[model samples]
Target chain A: MDSNGFRPEHRFDVELVAVTKRYGGTVAVDGVSLRIPRATYCCLLGPSGCGKTSTLRMIAGHEVISEGDVLIHDVNVTDLPPVQRGTAMMFQSYALFPHLNCLDNVAFSLKARGVPKPERHRRARDYLARVHLQDYAERLPGQLSGGQQQRVALARALITEPRILLLDEPLSALDPFLRGQVREELKRLQRELGITFIHVTHSQDEAMALADLMVIMEAGRIRQAGPPREIFERPADAFVARFIGGHNILRDGAGTIAVRADRCRLGIPEAGPHIRGRVAAVEYQGSSVRVALAVDGGPPLSVVMPDDRFFAGPVQPGEEAALTWSTRDAHALPDPA
Target chain B: MIGGGARSRDPREKRPWTFYALATLMGVFLLFLYGPMFVIYLLSFQGPNGGVTFPMVGVSTVWFEDILKPGQMANIPVAFGRSILLAAIVSTITVLVSVAAGLGFRRRFRGSGILFYLAVASLVMPSLLVGFGIGLGFQLFGWKADLFSSALAAQLTWTLPFGLFAMFAVFNRFNRAYEEAATDLGANAWQRLRWVTLPILLPGILGVAMGAFTLSYDEYARTTLVAGNRNTLPLEIYALISSSTSPTLFAIGTLTTTVSFLVIGATLAFVFRLQRRRALARHG
Candidate 1:
């Protein structure tokens, strides 16, 4: 299923049409619709029980459909089983078979499909090498470290060469250090494989780091969907603006303005006429120093300075700093309109 | 086949020494509870004087030869072979039907709760009643069964219930993620079952098979009633013990006991390995 990288002219073209999943009385997914680029890495970002996992499972056919169509390569596969869906999922738990060694686990689907052992092993080993776990091929899942096990899971999913790859908080099980390591590895693998990957995660940074096309969900609905940069800079609603990156959402008559703090510069500009605020709090978060200012022209605004040299030293809490941003960065999202 | 989780660094594991002593005491108690099968084995080789004397008064293969004759000697083998055949039949059917029933129960439906209760009832029912019911049911149908059918019928009484519950226990810790991952990877229902489900259930199935074999093979009362003309080994042995003490009975006892001991020992060993694997999984 490997293909050339996304030709900017081509749309990814995978669609979820009116997908509504109800669990008895509980409506888990509320008629969600999304279209992902063919080779783009799409991320579904939300809090727990926001129907992110349910949506992913629905796509995988692990959950029977209540109503909707999942069109893959333009075919409506609503009644198709998971295997027939031509998609693969990397689970949060990895779900590696304990009895099988890394090689065998990777080759399981192949064996199940009655692929010849020799060819399956060869293909499996190749996928494992891509994950840099070729050396530990014969070791069972229990023998591998958490990160290694995750890679084995990736290899197993990849060996079958499904059209789409689904990741469900795949890095959640790893320790913090291993998490960063595997995240980078997964990003690298997705890039190298040139496959469509739909990742479901609750972590904002993870979504920002890897998403080409990201969907932000709130309370079982698609709050917003776009390129990560677009969603971050121009959210469709207050929920999207707050979720993608923290935004200072200011309500107006027609819509709300979302201004990213880093884009807002604090200086002694046109005092009250522009944006005026007394600094309430200031903290250095390694690379950027965040200055929380109480803006009078609007709601209290937060300003971030990447210019570490200016705010590198101690800055008093009660200092007055006026915040400013170009009209372009301050985009308006119609409040759930 | 054991994994790292088999051994623990916990201080609690050291408490087993105390348990070991108690278990040994209990074993000695059980030995007294069931009098000398051990003594019978020892006395089997007694000389023509009907008593064991240390001076080997010319050991005779007479007892062995006596049990080896066609009418009687062939009887145990026929019965033993019949037991194996019957157990195998029952074990296979038990696994097939129970696996289906168990999967259905786990999946849940309108009547699944009642179905689950019925399954549990099958398990909780006294073996005596099950044998009696099946035997009486067979008689009402005018099915006159010889030893093989009798053993098969009796075996099903225990094996069917045993299979359903053993598999249910195995599924207690099942990960839906496996099926999810498989489905997402493009496996159909059959593929998921064969590649994912069955593999997870294998060790449990093996343990149940051995148990089913033993339960069917060692049954006395059930076999006695259902077995109209058939003299399976258990029935033959019971009649021997009831009528008079015979060296032939001890020989048969030694054979059956050895088989049962080995089966139970292997089952326990496999179960230990599985537990160890699960223990490591818990910490992980």
Candidate 2:
């Protein structure tokens, strides 16, 4: 029914049709087209200023689209406000109302819609319980810990029961340990609610761990969009290969190619391509040992080896080693446009 | 091996020469600030037949009693009431207009810079000149410069800029994310302003209102030319100073200073209570 073949029954929760965002003369999101399936977890992964947050804000209707249309549930929501478009956003800092308690923060939307106090409070309490924050209903956001504040934010965003939830760097403020816990909770909540979530983050690990559909953006354009494993196995270009860490981008006579750091061995292959370089640094990372190779006239590369395999041979810094991987393991990357 | 005989100097025990110099400067500044008011307070209690000098002729409350009686020099009670009414009007208008302008200024628009410079430019102009200009305009228009009209306008020229700058400080620290979050949560513009923005900015708004009221209450130069026939308390006090010097003038000064202190004290207490109510709850 649309250019992206979106239909009501197809149940695509969000679709961006060549959406572009501009500030003055400069473009932030340059004609990006994406379709997020219903109930899927999608991540817009890119470096800072790569337009991921701008794109997310455009989708959430916080930022106006400069060109093209945004559709939600087969409805053209380009001109609609965030509330009318059935989208709610959780800001990077959580943006909880500091003056209000957790219960009031979560009930704010319903109150805005003219819901009665008792009914909204009852609903807000249920939402708080959903986020395991029932006891924190009376506590202000400042009284809560960072993780608790994030959960309260989550409850506030979810109380609207939006068709799509937009999160902008939701875990960047939390400690590393709490990030993992919140990540798990977010995944579980998304599954339980059966709604689409489009998250923006610069961390590739967060994207790979959470996204069912991962979109890698460079500058103002989306470079690749697919499953995490698919992009990991066959990166679309050198930028994608480099942006998605744990992959070594190598140049040869044929073209640029990407091979997983784990797949590359520390010795010359019996009958395949190999490069010789000196070990620049060796880092012990508990489960794995990372060996940085400094090749002459080339970018540095790393090999992540299992700790047991690394200690068995014991390669030290400044030692010469030949890196090789089977041809089958090497995936050729496309040139940049 | 470290020797026990050598001792490390305690940082707190040492004071640089600059510290003593600055301390003396601060002490002198405070004395200069409060010394005149202290003398006025002492002289306000002079006896019935005492002069305005510092000899303190048997301290009593006679000069204070003179404040309530209408004298040939000036009507103290009427001018005092007029001063309060004018200040209330000016304070209310300053808060309304400055807050609206402050919110509008959060976004840069065409000619916004020029508008801001023009508004702030009034602060550097002589206060008497500002009133003179307004009085001239009223004369040209064949209008009477009364207490509420030209006087109120001239006083606002002094207070509005202060109110606007105070709001700039308030909004500089205000997080815009709250507005965005309100929008995302389905709050319309009016609802967002009423329920979120105003409540969050209440403390800052209260401060601006208090500052404007104080500025307007004590204003003399800006209101002098435009005050027409009737006078504010400050103008009446100035008239009494020229016509006849009495301990009653010191009583008026003491009473006004006390009123100012009470106003400032009440506002601070209210703001403190608001802050404490919204402060982070202590955890066990």
Candidate 3:
């Protein structure tokens, strides 16, 4: 067994023990601990200033941990440089070297390690081909489209062969249509490489689509950590329920609970918990139509209905509506700490 | 046809009165700027019997030849060599120090604000007074002031701030993600700087070098007290001006102005070539 008393089968690819980052009087990332398994796609999901990026940077060895330790492959890497930490970060902007062509950009890590020219170039070309960019070897980053640049960045990071790849909002810069395509490519890449991938993003949809383990963070702490389905079904608190969209948070005699928008029905049920409010909005989202309601004593709510179901009995914006959900669909959320 | 004619005429049919006024003002400004330089160029080619005036006595290159003879009052070639050497030194030092300072200032540290203000404060200080202070300090230390020593230090005070400010503008637009990406790709600190940072900042550094070179080449007031025994080109020209007036002075002026133009032209051509190469790759 290792010094941390973990069995061989239970060893995590990356582990953080109460890692904290403080700048002067303010704490940026306050005591975050996490464990990501081998080959798992883990996403740190949070809003701006929620320390998700800081946690990712700490794991990559880019930011120093003020309080605790960061361990990679069961080895403490808190004092090591990024190169020694076995982590590669793909930046949000892709950050490809503007002056270097695609081939040189991908070969940068090999060059840094003092590898000779022809060998590095050959290996770099192979990696580029993996990213489907072999034809654009000589093109500079500026010559490539936004999505192509991100692939080049991926190839550049992959050349290092790090055990864990840290992605900081890699798909945020792409257009919506391109974001989905790139997202699929990233997941396929992670699976094929069989390495742990830790991605940080503010988009709940992105996290839900890619993450095997979705970590919801708020104000430098993890609000909930589980599979996407688990977190979606049972958010730890009101904050997480709101941040992970399409959840209707309601408060009644039984305290706070979160119900999926798709599970919420418009007409009042014969029996079961229900909320009455004025219909605030009706939005058509191609396959699904969303109906937002303004409640008197609680936050606004929304109900997502199938387009066919919504059209059967259309509800106008100014009409009064009663939203009801089955008791099993309603999950209790703890009060915010 | 009527709609098309009206649409075409709408944009260009009328001229604003301010346009004519501004155009006339620009014309006069250009004439005022180049008027004396044109006269100096004409007078520099005056014949042996010619004077430094608009009425050319005869068309000859005698004054240009006279500039090479090393007259009793001045040694143009030696002073010119000294000026070039000093300016080169000053330019190199300014670029190196200011680029380093610019990178260091990216991160907030203790006394960073105070240090930045102190470095930039030299820009607004009177040049002569700064030279006088350096000269006085040399006297106190019993050190001899010369072109390479005290004068080099003095010129840096003038050029380094400009270099620092230029570098600030360069670094402002520079994305820190590039450096972080380099680091993540396993490059050490020095490797990241040499391969990534320096190549990206090269254009701004070149501009800083060119600026420092010209400023040092033409600097006279600051270098006056610090240049103890031997004189630089500008000081030599000043001495010649006080001693007498001749077409030879115009020759010297034209020669120096030509050198300045060549330096600026070469720098611009190099920067343009670098940009074009990048642009070509972007559109290729």
Best DockQ among the predictions, by candidate number: 3
Work out the TM-score per prediction: 0.77, 0.93, 0.90
Per-residue alpha-carbon lDDT of candidate 1 for residues B175-210, written as tens digits (9 for 90 to 100): 777776666655668988987778777777777777
Candidate 1: misplaced stretches above 4 Å? A1-10, A112-114, A248-285, A288-337, B1-82, B124-126, B183-191, B245-255, B267-284
TM-score for model 3?
Answer: 0.90
**Cα lDDT of all candidates, in order?**
0.76, 0.90, 0.90
Which RMSD does model 2 reach against the true structure? Answer: 5.2
- The residue-by-residue lDDT of candidate 3 on A74-131, one tens digit each, is 8888998998878999998888888899999999999999999999999999999999
Quality of candidate 3 docking, DockQ: 0.47
Question: What is the per-residue lDDT of model 3 for residues B203-278, given as tens digits with 9 covering 90 to 100?
Answer: 8889999999999999998999999899999999999999889999999999999999999999999987776555
lDDT computed for candidate 1:
0.76
Per-residue lDDT for A1-337 in model 2, tens only?
A: 7553435475588899999999999999899999988899999999999999999998888899999999898888899888888899999988888789999999999999999999999999999999899999998887788889999999999999888999999999999999999999899989999999999999999999999999999889999999999999988988898899888899766888899999988985566788889999999999999999999999999999999999989888999998888788889877555
Clashing residue pairs in candidate 2 are: none
For candidate 2, give fnat to 2 decimals.
0.59
DockQ per model, Cα: 0.28, 0.44, 0.47
Which whole-number lDDT from 0 to 100 does residue B21 have in model 3?
A: 98
